[model samples]
Target: MSAGTAFLGSAGVLLIVTLIKLWALRKNPNDPILRAVCGTLFIGALLFVTAAPPHLAKINNWFGTPNIAAPIVYCILTAFDAVNIVLLIHWRGNDDAARTRRQTRLCLTAYVAVMAAIVLLFTMGDAPVERLRDLDTYYANTPFIREMIVLYLAAHTVAAVTMTVLCWRWSRQVPGSLRLGLLTIAAGSSSAFLYDLLKYTAIVARWSGANLDWLSTHAAFSLAGVSALLVAAGFLIPPLGQGASSRWGMFQQFQRLKPLWLEIQSEIPRTCPKPMSWWRSMDLRLMQRERDIHDAVLRLGPYFDASTGKRVYAEALAEHAERRRARGEADASVIAGAVIAKATARPAVSPEDRWMLTSTEDPEDLVRMSDALARSPRVQAIRRWAALVGSRG
Candidate 1:
């Protein structure tokens, strides 16, 4: 795809994601940080959309001035930058504190001043050529326009540098996906600084009669676009990405226990009230399977011989010598397998003695036990022990 198409596509996706998050945030309107973050992202995407070559003329027409879209875009972008820092401050847990409130107020005041300066400067400048895509480059030699470009770029550079430092420091304190997300944001913020530096240097070079238009008009904008995309992903990855990962983990765990669930369901079909359907939610199906497995185990409680567990534990201890030695989980699996085998044999047991098999209540132990029953030498040995013990009786 062309550069314009790629930039537009990325901006479109970011807009959609921001809108969706904004919609969700509606339920909790009291959250200032959430609103600020979402607003910053949405406005950043809007800046890209409005500043694209195809829409630049329409924007200028909407504002009723030659190349007037530049100031408006810069104003939104400046606000976006300020809001990013405000978000970082709030995320640092000083929300209700006086210091945080003061800092936030200062950021807003600075943003307003920047926006006012941009508007005032742009209003006084004369852009007779009315360039859409390269207004800053076109007016680089103009007096008021030069100052206006410098002002906006300076504001952008400060925000980028501040965010990079804040995110870099905060990244080390966070854990899991959030740490990665912060690192990603810091990298993107650093890119934004590079973008502003390039643009500012190119504009300054123009004052000396140098033709560095390609740096400001092409390279800088490309870096800005890349920074926007990476920053958007970083903001989204902590919550949405982690949520997706958790769902995938649940699905994987459910699939792993399918063999044991099916085996229990085959013997006691009534344990599950109905067959699984595609219409059921994955979590709901997993819940039902867990409930069915527990119920099946309970129905076989009378057959759960405690002596069988004792005998298997002894054999496993002899083989491993130490419970904390290698293959600790193998020892656990052997014990659980013995329980399964004894339950299958239907031996007599007192109600109090049946509690000995309660280890299956733990989800971890259940998975290990289920896996052993599905495919393990320990389970095979337990089955052989059951047969031999049954014959001797």
Candidate 2:
């Protein structure tokens, strides 16, 4: 891809990622991890925007100084390196607050030093010629400009290596989307390190009187652009993937509860409005269904009997059903009996006469009970027995 296209594409991706992170962070504005990641992404986008050849020339002209964009780019890169390290340290997460603070301070100190040195060297150096795309090679032999270039490149190169090693290592320890994101970050960091290496090799070759400016002017730029896209994508995947996964799971849970929900609504009358398209968040639907199920459970509480559960459980085991499935079957029978008793208008048992299974009546256990209620023939038989007795009552 062309350098302008590469730079622009990377910048656009970063800006989009940054906006997403910012939106997510608003719920907890004090989150260090989100803040760090957000800052790094924004800075990276800025770096790419400023480093593009046309932008570099425009910036130099804007300031009315020859090669002035060089120092600005270097300072921004140095800042990007510093912020990235701070993010890594935060991402790793140390338990010791003091140690984390100390480490963060040290990284910031080094970053400020690098930024100051870049500005100082640029001021001291005289590069009157305007060399936008090939400034590194063009000024490779200049006194102070040489130091400024080396400083930023060295900092960025070190950050790249650190990012590659840490992210790759951490990826092994994690699972799911986080692991994938970390791996992508490692790839991007590796590309960045390669770009920096090319720049270094090209500059050093100039000192030896060889022409290898294409390494910096072409190959390095392309690699840097590729790195930007990879890193932005790495940051994006984890949150987006996790959000999608959670929504899918919630959708499944909502569907699972439907049979039981329909069973309750069929016998008992409650006015529930159909959810509109905008009201169709899976989580909201799941929560509302859980509330309805729990309400039904409470109304049918008096119909549950302790002895019936034991008898049903014993019968299930006698049939050689697996332990968990047998328990689910037993629970299903008790719930089924309650539904029958309520429908048949059986008189309520006293509070002291009521009994429930050991299982907490949470949504998870309810799902299991509902699954069994929908499928188990044994539960049907047990409920038939209860219905006969309930008919007598």
- Winning candidate number (TM-score): 2
State the TM-score for model 2.
0.90
Against the true structure, candidate 1 has what lDDT?
0.74
Per-residue CA lDDT of model 2 for 1-393, tens digit only, reads: 766677877788788979988898898799988898898899889988998888888998899999999899888877877877798798788999899989999989988998999999999999999998899999999999998999999988888898899998999899999899889988998998999999999999999999999999889977876786677667667877899999988888888877777766643436655433535777887877777766667667787866667787888888976776667677778778777777888876666656665433566767777787788887778778878976787
Model 1, span 1-393: residue lDDT tens: 765577678788878888888887998888976787687678778877876776777877877877888888889889888888887778777636989989989998998899999999988988767786577777898989888988999999999999899889988888878888888889889999999888978887888888788888888878887887777677777877678888787787788777667656644546357847857777887787788777766665665555555555566568767443213234334344434555456455676654255445666666755665677666566667766666665
Candidate 1 worst ten-residue window by lDDT = 324-333
lDDT of 2 at 381: 86
Which stretches of model 2 miss by more than 4 angstroms?
A: 267-279, 317-325, 349-353, 357-360, 383-393
Runs in model 1 lying further than 4 Å from the true structure: 1-4, 23-37, 90-105, 124-128, 141-143, 171-176, 267-281, 317-348, 385-393
Q: Pick the candidate with the highest lDDT.
A: 2
Against the reference, the lDDT scores of all candidates come to: 0.74, 0.82
